[model samples]
Target chain A: MRNLSSRLSRWLISGPPLLYLLIFFAAPTLIMVFAAFRIPGDYGGLLPLLQTDDAGKTEVLINAGNWHDFITFENFGRFFEDSIYAELFLKSFWYAGITTLICIVLAYPLAWLIARSNKKTRDLLVLLVILPFWSNFLIRVYAWMIILGPQSYFSVALNHLLALVGIEPVSLLFSQFAVIIGLVYVHLPFMVLPLYANLEKHDMALLDAAQDLGANAWQRFWRITWPLSLPGVWAGTALVFIPALGMFAIPDLLGGTNSIMIGNLIKQQFLDSRDWPFGSVLSIMLTLSVLLMAAIAGWAGRSKKERA
Target chain B: MALLEIRDVVKTFGDFTAVNHVSLSVEAGEFFTLLGPSGCGKTTLLRMLAGFEQPNAGQILLDGKDMSQVPPEKRPVHTVFQSYALFPHMTVAQNIAFPLQMAGVAKADIPARVDEVLEDVRLQQFAKRLPHELSGGQRQRVAIARALVNRPRLLLLDEPLSALDAKLREEMQLELINLQKEVGITFVYVTHDQGEALALSHRIAVMNKGEVAQLDAPETIYSYPKNRFVADFIGQCNLLDAKVAEVGGSRMKLEIPGVGLCEALPVEGAQVGQSGTLTLRPEKIRLAAAVTHDADEVHFKGKVHDCLYLGDVTIYIVELENGTLVETMLPNSAPGRARFFDDNDAVELAWRFDAGHFLLG
Candidate 1:
């Protein structure tokens, strides 16, 4: 009776979430992976794998004699056949990399300031960082769009200054610059929160020890503070890079013709072009790349721990 | 000439003065200690010596050079912080080699010096270990080695052993004494633990408030405290309120209100009819069931009020005929349970004529 009760209790603890993920998440992902290798029907979705004759006996439509009856690798081949898909992925990586760098550069000083503040002020600053999440993300992006548009006061003043400096006046909205600004603005809090958590735990006595041991201010920061904060840096990098790499909405709203990334193309293939098999193939590749990136980061972090 | 000197140093934060007009000099190769309770400005004064903070109204001279505008990094001094502040990211050897690297020592000479100091502290086998990998005592030794690797003229230690357990603290105290002797670097140590200060220091400056109450050798500070503050702070002492009835040379007669006349060694400027306290140590007084007292001893008739057995020694609280309680400690030299006195037992408490020192108000 005791053993049965213990087993029942364990099941009760893990039953709901396990069942929910299996039904909602795991099932859909497996279907998508299977669809990636199937042939597209005349309409949109995957072709039927089984067919029924007039006599009410079902027969498999899959045939090794016919290449494209039910299943094929044609969707994956189309992706590699067109160099446009590879270039789009490279562009997305570049945009995400730049956004991550800019977020770090802007977030570090803000995090340090917040971490060093007194208790009451530190709470208020951290609240301000998280307050952006309370509102609709689309509404925040739309607000940036208004600010970056040509007729807005900010863009007019910026272009006026550029004209005065002997440079040509330029449009700010619907450009790569606008897309980058939007990406960094949305992802900045991810970098600051982890960096702040790490910096807050540091002991000030270590800096005093460094200074007492004949290190200048710059040397103390470079040798002591910077090296100690690497774990936070890596965490912030992963948080910002993963989302920025997969983002589509910012580029859709703010990017020009040349700035469209792989996310935009994947959305077009699924909804506008009605190419479900091609879309599934693109999604699988995207998922694999994200997983590969996470694996590399985890490996790097573990190796660093072992050596350090 | 002294190796380091401070003249009228004062440090203030807003309206509160942390170190007020403190002045002292440390000799070369001397182990000097600043002993005080918390917030007595011992740490503040030590920070000034290390050039971490500048004095508000005085000059600090190190090696006869004025150090007013010098920053901490420029000063030829280092500190072993209380928390053992060894860099967590650096290994034991890297932590010790930090100062040498910062000082721009040649790359070839760095490894040899770091290894030597590691061997000196007997942590050669754990040179590749991180600070968190070591025990508390090992981390402490790493901190010391890191500070001493550069061989500065002065080393400041701020309660470096307070984080250890009692046994470990005692062991580290002895190690600290030996390290100081071997390095021959002038040490300016600060701690609030009086026993630690007494055991390690050549000279101790007992501080109260933001000022030095007394500066003397360990023996002198323990046996001949100059004031009620210094007397009470260093160890357990009984201060009996007394009035000087007769003053003569180095000896004076004091009238304890109900205990009648007793003689005590006088502080300077003792006069007749002056009121003061007689600071008497616990071990100086003798407690027994019966006593054949000498003429040079002041004797009292009392009842044993309570007793505490402390393995090595036991302290007895005796209530005199006048209702004043006095404590006396005796060695537990016997092999058995070492309980000498019990409650409500009639006893005699006696001390030599000069056992107590009188501090006038």
Candidate 2:
């Protein structure tokens, strides 16, 4: 009886935060899933409908058919049949992969240079890398749009230069390339920081020993330095890839209609089309894909640890 | 001709000089040691020899060729770092074969050379283990095997045994000596342990303040140290301040105030009426129960301040009339031989005239 009282007291002390999470976070998500399967009116409003059973009595319905039309898998089939949705999904994956690869290539040398530099220079470089992150991310992405858009300062200057060269002015705004550039700009620091943290902890004595053992510069890097920094590489790539996969703001602002990604499609279904069922299905798929990627990355990390 | 010659090497980092105009020559196939305290430039000099660091002004000649501009990868030298610095990503066999692979040796021949070196270091069973899986001594052997597989003209060791415990360090030292003899490669070892240097080195160069104070055989360095620093650094010695009262062809008379006069051998630059310090080894001084024969030459009366009974020897800290404390060692010949001395026991200290070395400025 005494232990039970103490346990009850402990739970009472910790109950407020748990209650807050349940009311604010968990209840809203469950309500969203509940709303996703409700019957739709002509204007796509969720309204309860009546059903007549064998007893000749009318009853208000909240069944599977009212939610998702008797679980026919129609939402998934519709997603696959639509070329636009399929293309957007593929484009999102491709863009994220490209961004990750580019980030890795550009960040490795910068991180290596920072790690090898003297103390004062290393501090300056780190400050420069982190200075952009201090500003609001939306403000930073918007700044890129202004710089790269036509009639902006850079585009106007380029137009003048092209005129002098007897060439026609080119459109540099609302392109897929613009969105990729913005993604890379925002995520480059994420990649460089982790790589720098790992590379800085490396023992320089190993490099000298390798050279003394007759390894040239390239051989030393390939055989010793690169393999040792794999953990950082994996982490930095994941940091850039996961968020870039779901990015909507940059693609919506910088990309034209033809370059829309899966995130923009999901946004359209929810707000523009007011179709909650299809939107939920798309959200679930995207979340599952991301979770799958995370699981794979985690497995790889564990295997590397075991090998080490 | 010398296998390696350092001609007036001077290295400075900004304003701090690490090696101050040092010069030495090492013959081929010799085990030479540079012994000193930390920050004494022993490792710096060794690094310069290996071409890791270039001297501000000097020439390093190896095998009749100048190696001042030669990169470390191109030089015919290797180093076993104190940390072992083994490649963490590679197995033992792969590490031993790395240099051979880098040199573009045939793939078949590389394995044979790797096996040969692995056998030499007695690490054949550990050929497939990574560096992290091996013990400290085994990692050290792998480092040696890796360096030896390249067949470098010289091998440099920078306090390689310092990371190990006492017993493992002793074992590694003997192994290193045996390996050097078998490989017939010149070894330039750097260590601060006087005992290790004396044991493993054919000749030792004792360094102090970025300069070589004395370089000679172990016996000569221990007995005939050129300066007070070398005398104090090598072993325990009782240094006494004395004035040269009289000088002769082979011997001199020194006046040690409060301890009476003493006859000592004159160093090379002794002069009359000059104040100098005399060095006497602890083992050379003997303790007598009473005044004995030949006591007038060199003897002093003192009281035992403290006594330490080590397993092999009993150490006596004797206090003289001048309040100077002297430490002397007595061998324990029999089981009860050390029981005679106690704290505050009256004792007589005596040594021969030749045992005292007068240090001249």
Candidate 3:
């Protein structure tokens, strides 16, 4: 009787989250995978799988006799047929890669400083890193818009400095640079949090040992700190890169027309062009690519462990 | 010239002084120890020697070179931390090779040297294993091997054996002695364990409140401590509160509170009718039910109050007539579980005339 109660409690605790994920996340993903193989409707969404004759009799139209009418592979074919889609995917990868690298470079020192600070100030610094979440994300992007605008003081100062060297005044707003800045700004906390957690658990004695064994400052960091903090780096990469790769809002606001990424194309396929099947195909490919990257990272980490 | 010398070094953290005007010199190829309790400035002294902490007003001359300007990286010294501090990500071999790689030793010689040190520590078969994969003793050996791989002029060990269990600690103590003899490097060790210091050091400096209370050979420090602190800190002792009644050369008569006048060795500049303490070891007392008389011995009478039965030795706490407790240790070598004395049994205690050392206020 006690075992039964314990088992019931276990299920009761886990049931809500399981049901929610199955209904919201897993069901939509399965439906999208099925949609990627279907034909586009005359107006929008997927084609109907049933039809009625003139005699008012209902019949199924998705069988082998008329399978081509409802079921199709052309949506998947179109993604491969057009090189433009492939180029857009490449552009998105490049943007996400740069954002992740820059985030690591910027967040590492901040995280280290927070980890090394005394207990009284450490909580305050971590709270400051997370304070951006309190305000609306869209509002933060708009704030960036003002900061990088053509008439803002920052851009004016940069242009003035460029004029002194006989260089052309450059536009900071609605450019690739603006897009990168927005992406990095939005995802920096994700990088900092995980890196801080990893750095905080590190033993300070290791650095002393390294130094006592004749390691200079740079060598100590490169040899000891960097290698030990790889797990955090990878975790931060996943948190930032996955979301940045599928981002459309930043590109829509700051990219103008020259920097439209794959995310922008996917949004346009479903909403503007009214092609849900093709959109599903692009979304599925993005998911697959992310899974492949995760697999490669896992394999690399495991192999290193085995070697050690 | 000494291999390592500190000329009046002082370290302070704001209002608190960690190491205060400490000066000492260590000879080359000697096993020296800084012994103290927690926060007694021994660690601070070791840090100064390792170049981790700079002295506010002093110079550290290592091998006749002023080490004030050199950083920890440039100093020819390495430390085995109490926690071992082995890099978790690196294998045993890689951990040992880190020093060689940082020193820019010839790339070709790095592997051989790492392997050699690993073999010396008897960890060759575990080279490919990570630090967490090994036991605590193995990890300690790895830390030692890593520090000794490049053979720095001096090796500093900051209470490296304090983390192990009692059995493992004794085993490692013997191993440390053997390893030091094999390496022949000048060692500067710091620990709060007085027994460990006594067992390993050729010379010991006992510190108290950021200053050295006594510095001498281990035998002298143990047998004739310069002050009450060193005598009390090193081993179990019976300190009798006494006053000097008369002084004659190195011998003096001390009138203890309950045991009457006793003979002991006087401190320098000993004056008659001054307050002092008579420190005597428990093992030095000749304890028995009734004893034969010696020519130059002080005899006393007491009743056994309590007894502790350890495997090799048993301690008998005897209460004198005036309510003073004195402990005397006897070996339990009679091949059975029988103890020497029972509680409330009257016993006799005696020691030689100059066996007790006296410290004056």
Candidate 4:
């Protein structure tokens, strides 16, 4: 009797949350996957045709002929057949890759400074890095919009300097550079936090030892510091890259018409084009690629551990 | 000329003085140890030698060249840190080759030199393994090998054996001595363990409060410590407060409170009727129930206050007539050997007249 009560208590603690996930998350994902394999309705809805059973009773059943259409890979076939989707996919990867690179370049020196600072200074710097999270992310992005706008103070001053140099006045917003700047600005802390945590635990005495053994500052950094902090580098890269790939708001707010990424294309398919099956197909592809990236990262981390 | 001359070096961090006006000269090919307790600034001196730290005043001369402006990499020095500080990502061979690589040894020549040093440390079989894969002793050898690989003029060891277990520390102590001799590099070692210092050093500078309290050969430092700090820090010692009764040639007679008139070596500036202290090592004093009279020895009567049976030796805490406590060590020789003196046993202890070194109070 006690065993039954204990089991009931365990279930009571976990069962509701698990059931909620099943209904809210798993159910929608399962439906979306099933819908990806079917043809869209005339009005872009996913209502399967109802049918009656041979038993003298009416039943709500999916049309079996739709399976034949799914087997033909109609949605996937159309997605691959379109070159614009392929171009958008590549463009998304390029933007995400460049953003991750820029974030790494900017975060490393800042993270090193934080790690090397005294305790009080370190706490204040880390707080400054995290202070932005207290403000609304969308509002922060909008703020960047004003700062980078063509007629804004920064751009106007930049244009004056260009005019002094006899160069053309450059438009700072609604460009690829603006999109990259937005992505880097948003994702920098994601990179810095992990790198700082890793570098903070680094044995500084190793640098001293290296120096005593005839290593210059640059050699010590390249040989001792950089290689040891690879795990954090990879972690920060994933944190920046995965989200940047599917980011919609930053590109929509700052990028030009030429900057339409896979995320924008997918949004257009589901809403404007009313192509539910194609949107589901793109979402599945994105999810698979992310899982693959995570798997590769895990393997790299494991290999590094084995080598160490 | 000495290989390294540290002339009146001082280091201060804010208001705290870490190494204060310390000066020493280390000869080439000597195993010199800076022996002290923790926070005694021995490691700071060693760090300054390695050029990791700069003295606020005074200068360090390596091979008669002033190293004030030279950075650690350019200086002809290397250090083995207490933590070993071997690169965790590098293999044992790679760790050993680090110094050579930093010195710009050619890639083709690196592996052979690494192998040679690895063999010197007797870690040839573990070359492919990472530092985390090795044992404590093995990692220590790797650190040592890494430091020695470049053939630096001086090798500074900052309490490298402090991390090892007792047995491993002893074994590494002997290995380090042999390695120092083989390399023939002037070594500046720092350690809190007095036994490690005595076992390894040709000469020891006993540091106290950021200054060298006494610097001498191990035997001289052990036998005739210049001050109470060195005597107490080096080993088990019994200090007895005494008043000088008379001063003769090379010796003085002291009136010890517990033992009455005792003859001691006259330290410089010891005058008659002035109060002083006598330092006697526990091992130097012999205890017996009855003893033959010797002119060269001084004897005192006491009772055994406590007897401790440590495996190799038995310690007897003897209470002298005037209530001064003196500890004496008697060798056990063999296991289960009976002790001569037990608790409350009346005994007479004698030591050589020169055994009691006089120190100013």
Candidate 2 C-alpha lDDT tens digits along B134-232: 999999999988988888899999999999999999999999999999999999999999999999999999998899999999988888788899999
lDDT of 1 by residue, B1-361 (tens): 9999989999998998999888999999999999999999999999998888889998999999999988999899999999999999999999999999999999999999999999889899999998999999999999999999999999999999999999999998899899999989999999999999999999999998889999999999988888999999999999888899997776779999888898777667878999998989999998889988998899888998889888899999888878888989889997885888789999988899888888888
Q: Give lDDT tens digits, candidate 3, residues B197-252.
A: 99999999999999999999998998888889999999988888889888877677
Q: A54 in model 2: Cα distance from truth in Å?
A: 23
TM-score of chain B of 2: 0.96
Per-residue lDDT of model 1, residues A1-308, tens digit only:
99999999999999999999999999998998888888777787768788899999998877788746667788889999999888888889899999999998999899999999999999999999999999999999999999999999999999999999989989999999999999999999999999999999999999999999999999999999989988889899989998998899999999888898878888887888878888889888888888998898789878987876
RMSD of each: 2.2, 4.3, 2.1, 3.1
Please say which candidate is ahead in TM-score: 1 or 4.
1
Query: After best superposition, candidate 1 residue B129: deviation in angstroms?
Result: 1.2
Q: Report the C-alpha displacement of residue A286, candidate 2, in angstroms.
A: 2.6
> What clash count does candidate 1 reach?
0
Locate the minimum summed-lDDT window of 10 residues in model 1 chain B.
Answer: B262-271
Docking class of 2: medium
User: For residues B207-311, what per-residue lDDT tens digits would candidate 4 score against the true structure?
Assistant: 999999999999999988889999999988898999999986867889986568988777777778898778999998999897665998998898999988887
Clash counts for the predictions, in order: 0, 1, 0, 0
From the highest lDDT down, the ranking of the candidates is 3, 1, 4, 2
Clashing pairs for predicted structure model 1, backbone only: none
Per-residue lDDT over A44-150 for candidate 2, one digit per residue giving the tens place of the 0 to 100 score: 54454677889999986657656444333566677778787767778898999899999999999999999999999999999999999799999998888889989
- lDDT tens digits, residues A1-308, model 3? 99999999999999999999999999999999999988888998888787799999998778878888777889888999999888888899999999999999999999999999999799999999999999999999999889999999999999999999999999998999999999999999999999999999999999999999999989989989999899899999999999999999999888879888889988998999889999999999999988998999899889977865
Candidates, DockQ: 0.87, 0.69, 0.88, 0.83
Model 4: fraction of the reference interface contacts it also forms: 0.95
* Over 4 Å off, model 2: A1-42, A45-68, A116-127, A160-168, A292-308, B243-266, B269-271, B291-297, B321-323
Error of 4 at A120 (Å): 2.9
